[model samples]
Target: MLVRTAYRLETGLREAASRVALRIGWTAAVLPYPGYGTQGRARVLGRVLLAPTATDPAARRGVPGWQRLLTLERPGVDVVVELGGSRRTVRSDEGGIVDATLDVRMPEGRATATLTVGERYDTATVHVAPDDARLGVVCDIDDTAWVTNLHDPLRAVWRTLARSSGGRRAVPGMAGLLQALRGRYPDAPVVYLSNGPWNLAGPVARFLEHSGFPAGPLLMTDWGITPRAWFRDGQAHKRSSLERLVEDFPQVSWVLIGDDGEHDPDLYGEFAARHPDRVAAIALRQVVPRPRERAVADDPPPDSDHDGSTAARAPSGTLVVRAPDGTGLLRGLRDALGVEPDRAGDDDVGW
Candidate 1:
């Protein structure tokens, strides 16, 4: 069960979100939706839905019905009912709200796709098709994307409080790689899922946009939760957040990128194993990529199959390409995705 705790957003940030909420859906998880990015209205940064775009019929769009946007990260998920079926069906009005389902599948030949939206967990399976396509680029910020010198995370934390965070330099050529991904797949989305908190958005965006990093969707945790709080601490359902992203974008394959310092490799490994095909490639960012960690990403610990991390779905094709600098990870995306394209629709590209 989702225990909604009262999180204390920094007064200043809370005020900003309240003002923006009138224009956008500025809740913590995915905010600024439906307004404000562009003055009176923010660009529809992105919307989460169970169905794919019907405009692209060949693109494997989900049947139009009442489906809410569920998790889109490590265990990518979504739900839809196929009534026409060999299926099941539901009806909705134009603005993306579902009133009710018209009918249930009574015929024996009909197989309704009533994929239920269930409890938020480490891994939840949802409808996914192989032929479908979308943009795919995984991004990371911090010492890798920028020279925040997060080798000492505390210093980075202080820099944010001081609001001098933007003063830090950008990693060499990192922006070029992001630009490259943007240039290559304009329609595909690039997500920055960082350990950074909500307060860093303004400064971080300024630094990234100023230095040339493509400014797109960003995912950050709130600092409001105390570490002792089981879910909120540093371990809030980040994997769940990651799952939400992947599940939301059906076409986009995974181009995982991150540093070795924290659990990026481990997290990405678990994600890759579950949806190997979704993960086109992974570039672990680092100054000197350690051999041991690389080994872990490439070949997770033997007990991974039995471990909670890997217990989600059997691991997938998590190719951990070592990036000398943050730029290297970006460069590797072009290299790996180009040479060996995603399995097209092969969901099971296992270890």
Candidate 2:
């Protein structure tokens, strides 16, 4: 009883602190824009926002949702971004978020982007990997890579807030398997698409790095109401992300990796159906939400791939592999396309 009361008191204190912080007006920040671009002339995209200081740092630390609510938008602010020694000016929308894509031309290498909102400045760096990276891996982070209990949002929130960096566990051999999926290509990119709020980007990225997963761009969503939706939809965010990726890198063929914990299968399947030629394969991690949900030993449950059929041929010629875990996933990948995933850091990069 005392423990419960203490927790409630702590929560109340945090809420009060957050409210006080929100009332302190807005600060400008340049989000961690995707630092990746192609050779010749490439489009660079990022956002500028006027939000409470609580948003980015708290989100980076994986703080609870209540703290995140302190972030409110300040719109219509003119911002200037410096990219590759050039300056591009853009204005924020009514929601206090600015989406700007500037054209950059340079030889393939790493570049820094700087956003200046009056006197405040924020910077991000991105590498321009070769455009011929045909084999791309797109992954979902929640139950698929990091062990977040998406079955219960409250539990997930608690775990996220309570754990520090390196607290989250990788799903067994999933990290190694993801690295191996890069195949023989020199710069095969692995992009993470999650329904997780943008504030958690730092935590998620830290988790990935600590777990030995390959470095790739993390495409996460902004929490709360945006211009488009009253309550943001994960499905829509993922779909839009996929669309943008394909549109941006039409030359790259993608392999989608996700879990059956939620809508990954349906969304990935829908993507495969729409862009048959672009998707190489779909790998799904079979997860049992609750331990009690597992089948009794006396009567084994149905297999993840429908009665021991591991690979299914999608109408668009994409191979769908459903496996119990990462080991099974590796085996399925080998069977489907003779792919041998490489070790992590073969390219000596954290990005």
Candidate 3:
């Protein structure tokens, strides 16, 4: 009885200290969405945080450091964002997110937006796929880009918390495939959509850069409970993002890429079905399900059984790739977009 009482006291003290630390460490943070639109009226989206210091030890390993058990939304804070010569001010929502539009005259190329909250400033870039560009690529991060064992939640979290960009391993040849896609369509845009928590954005961005992948905008999400749901739906996040992208760029045809480990197949399939004309191709990575996956699963048969035969039903041009280290994706894209040899002499290589 005495030991139990002591443990309770210790736990209470730790909670109290954590609360105090959060209160003291709160600061302004801006999470900017990669804004894309036409020159006349481009839209900008971002979140403003009276952000508390992230205390999770996993942060050092590569998970988002700005995320915490408690979210302190600073509603009504005024934010200023600038692009080229145009500047605009908007207030954060009750959730501390800012979704605003700005008028700017940007010449063809990647454009940068500078967001400022008092002296704290951060920059985010947006891609403007050329008017005549034929294809766009929407990519998934987990099993599609690299292997993070989503089937085993604990193992996934440990890998994220223990690895740095250099320490982390990207799927071999994945970068080459993306780079080659850019080579095929010089002006095409590649957007990364991940259900991974936004706190790990820094590491993910670094990993992409180090791997020589083409540059584009990242759309990530927060990983805590919200008012309507007990837990966040990652599929829901990807769904909305895809909807927004399709709506925003009506003229651009998209090639979807993801792994079979999660809901990418279903989500991409559904998305392609709805917007058949806009979707050019859908590529899914074939992942071997682990023992834990079998023990905990009911629906969605394992990869070997599913075999992506069902994906063909999702869209007219859908196919599953083995993701044989990246060759599978390369082959899929080759069939979909007509893979071309990358020329180092040409300027198409870099962002």
Candidate 4:
């Protein structure tokens, strides 16, 4: 009863604020996110927000990450999405997120979709993976791809607030590792699945591109109060996103990459156990010493058998590799995938 009351109060406050913003001449704008799709269907992802009039220069310069979090959302707004020669009107959710799956056919490779809200418009890049593609990649963002220091909450918050996306450092060798995977499987799609809020999508996407990581789509969750809960469940978000990927791309076997600072090992283990055939391999970057507290039964203990140089098959028959950085994981991944090292360019490859 208390939860329901709090949700109602929150909804009421948001509605009141929306009305005031509209009365003061705030206009609706569209923020598009890169989405992934198969050959036959495409998922359009975006957000609708209430922003200052067209005269504001910040609209053109792009808002910073912290400012983005403070912006007002215009929920239930109508956004027209045009892709593959088809036009559809989709409604944003209560959180102003437009997540619509349309049955539009497009050839394999990168495609563009236009999203329009009133006079404001943005193009969302959609990656269409070939149906015959055998391999796909799902990577975590926080510690696996970039150095966010998630284990240290205070430092993580400070860095996120102080640093621009370009200023943030990418995990050494990770970009090269992802690029190598792309080189091997040219048609494979790379999906970044993170527990971070959607407000940081722009920054995260920028970081990935500027750091030379192969781009695909970002699947991030919304933060703050929900109708049913007060705070978002990060672990549940990751788990559900993983399951949805299995449903979205049934034929593609995924190479899951994440760090062991949190619940990644346990979560990936459970996923591999449930869908053994869907997973090709699991690569875990040892961001920090394995936590002393065992949060779950499936969490793998500290690596004592090898010095982050070998790939071992897990109990579920999936190959698992652990490394401190991408270079070590690259070696283990090559071994697991049975690919020869590109010795000619190995020395120059910096992630």
How do the residues 1-351 of candidate 2 rate in per-residue lDDT, one tens digit apiece? 555565556446645654555478556666654556664434443455455655553235545444544444445667787777667888876444555565776555567777677766676555565767677889899888888877778877876666654677788667867877654455766788998866566677778888988777777776654334445789999999899878877788788998877888778878887888778888878775332221111122323432232566655667777666776676666655554434473332111
lDDT value, candidate 3, whole model: 0.65
For 1-351, candidate 4 gives per-residue lDDT tens digits of: 777788899879878988898899988888889998895889989998887776431233344456657767788889999998988999998888998788888999889999898988888999999988889999999998999899999888876766668678999889988998998889989999998888888888888998999999999998877667888889999999999989889899999998889888889878988998998899888888653232222335434334454456666888877778888788777756768756566444422
Candidate lDDT values, in order: 0.45, 0.66, 0.65, 0.82
Writing each residue's lDDT as its tens digit, candidate 1 over 1-351 gives 123333233334444544555254322121111110110111122121222212211122221111111211111223233333323222322212221222322322112232222221111112121223355666777666776555567766554454443456777666776676666665445666677754354456556667877655566664443323424544344587668666555556777667666667677777776777687766665643343444344344422211111211224545556655544444344445563423344221211
Locate the minimum summed-lDDT window of 10 residues in model 1. 34-43
Ranking by TM-score: 4, 2, 3, 1
Regions of model 3 farther than 4 Å from truth:
1-34, 37-45, 51-73, 289-322, 339-351
TM-score of each: 0.54, 0.76, 0.75, 0.90
Those runs of model 2 whose alpha carbons end farther than 4 Å from true positions after fitting are: 1-26, 39-69, 226-230, 289-309, 340-351
- Compared with the true structure, the alpha-carbon lDDT of candidate 4 equals 0.82
**What C-alpha RMSD separates each model from the true structure?**
15.3, 8.2, 7.7, 3.0
Question: For candidate 3, lDDT tens digit of each residue in 1-351?
Answer: 555565556446545654665579766667666666543556676776554544322234433333332344455778898887889998987556677777665665678887877656667675656656667889899867777867778877866666655666787667877887787787777889999766566678778888887887787776654455545789999999999888666777887877767788678777876787888777666665431221112234424322122223232444434444455456444544554534354323322
Query: How displaced is residue 50 in candidate 2, in Å?
Result: 5.2
lDDT of 1 at 82: 32
lDDT of 3 at 235: 90
lDDT score for residue 196 of model 3: 79
Residue ranges of candidate 4 with Cα displaced over 4 Å: 1-6, 55-64, 291-307, 343-351
